[model samples]
Target: MGLINMATYLDIIRGTYEGTSEENGKRLRDALATDAVWTEAAGFPYAGTYVGPEAILANVFHRLATEWIDYRATVHTYVADGDRVAAFGTYSGTYRTTGKTMEASFAHLYRLENGKIVNMQQFVDSAMVRAAMD
Candidate 1:
């Protein structure tokens, strides 16, 4: 069997951060498996588990879009092995509720199956978010 490469993972990451437009969202959906699961770090306002593309879109993506202005994940480094990819980045946005802006480091781990992302876990500085919320 051939091994999964990092390029594909990078493509997914690139597409995800480009924007939240419908076409961009569609690219993200196409890269995810039907039963994909996304776990957000605890302490985050949207902290929870999201299953499937629809759930992820509704619970996580939608919240981000509605609650934050110019929310973007800017990746700085990428590490990959086998079907797993670890992306290090920063997330910057302005919280709608408080009109507070924040820039925090983040890491996202992705596991792919059949060339599609099946699982994802996010790590971020919750303190930064809390500060903004406060």
Candidate 2:
């Protein structure tokens, strides 16, 4: 199947966090290609370029699972152009260490191929996240 458009992509995003079930995680994982690349914005705690699904799972998802409580991305808008999708949203979470809740606007850009995400780049307010964690 060809890569999905922005609406379907957003639906997939919502499905990932709709429940605390392994099925959601599996769905999210299934959308990623093995050779996918994820780039986290610099200055964030887990900032770096993660290559491949395993590396992304370790560096990005693992950190989110450990460091934040009730972490959620509330998408406000989506724009799609061919296989590229842009999602505008806010990340809301409580920093596990400080117990301080924070909300930061973010833009996530994704490139998909054959219904799988091949690359992603995230933009967010690193300073706000740092302050929340402090």
Candidate 3:
């Protein structure tokens, strides 16, 4: 398959958040190459760089499973060009560890190759999270 258009790419990203099942996660994984690299900005305690699909599944998704009672991301804006898509959104959830509920802004940059995500970078309002925990 070749590169998917920007609208299609946005749809896929939205689907990843909207679909509430392992199947969705699997679908998202399928769209990602095995060697994909996912990086999150510093400041957020759980933020770290993850390489490969398996690493993201283990470190990012799995960690989210334990930390949040419920988590959802709402897209505020999306821009795409060729094989790259950038999304801005807010993630809201209840922190399982401290029972602190939060809604914070975030932005993600995704690079796709042959219809699969090969790299991703994320930025979140970690300072707000830190204050919420205090």
Candidate 4:
């Protein structure tokens, strides 16, 4: 008989953040299911539901990389329930155009299936993020 292997939802979600930025990104992209959907907060600049890893990279992560300086999401806590995991954190960055910095609380809720993230929704203080931009 062969043993079955599995990773808990918490472990899968936590692995996405508890690594170097490059590593984290790689882990995140690797963890996304082919048809995964990522939602950005309504008031945020990239406010839309992006589908698939390529779409997410183009719509969100690539913009963040190009538009901010020293941008970081510092996760403070994580909660896992069933197939959902929530990460509570603070986002800090300096807007490249305005040269202003802001820090705001943020939360990300993720739903997983078969060890891959199927959906993710972000909650953040868009005003705080916009303050830095303006």
Q: What is the C-alpha RMSD of each candidate to the true structure, in Å?
A: 1.9, 2.4, 2.0, 2.8
Q: 1-134 in candidate 1: lDDT tens per residue?
A: 15656777666666765665676788888888999999999988789999999999999889888989888888888887777888898988999999999999999998887678899999999899878878
For all candidates in order, the CA lDDT equals 0.85, 0.81, 0.79, 0.90
Per residue, candidate 4 scores C-alpha lDDT tens digits across 7-83 of: 37787788888888798899999999999999999999899999999999999999999999988999999987777
Q: What would the TM-scores of all predictions be? A: 0.89, 0.85, 0.87, 0.93
For candidate 4, the per-residue lDDT at 113 reads 83
Worst lDDT run of 10 residues, candidate 2, spans 12-21
* Descending-TM-score candidate ranking: 4, 1, 3, 2
Model 4 lowest lDDT segment of ten: 1-10
- The digit string of per-residue lDDT tens for model 2 on 16-123 reads 545564665677788888899899999877899998888998888878878899877777777777777788888889999999999888898888777778889999
Cα deviation in Å at residue 59, candidate 3? 0.9
Q: Ten residues in a row with the worst lDDT in model 1?
A: 1-10
Predicted model with the maximum lDDT? 4
Over the stretch 20-50, how does candidate 3's per-residue lDDT look in tens digits?
Answer: 6576687778887888989978988668888
Q: Order of all candidates by lDDT, from best down to worst?
A: 4, 1, 2, 3
> Candidate 1 — what's its lDDT?
0.85
Give the clash count for model 2. 0
Q: TM-score for candidate 4, please give it.
A: 0.93
Candidate 2, position 29, lDDT: 89
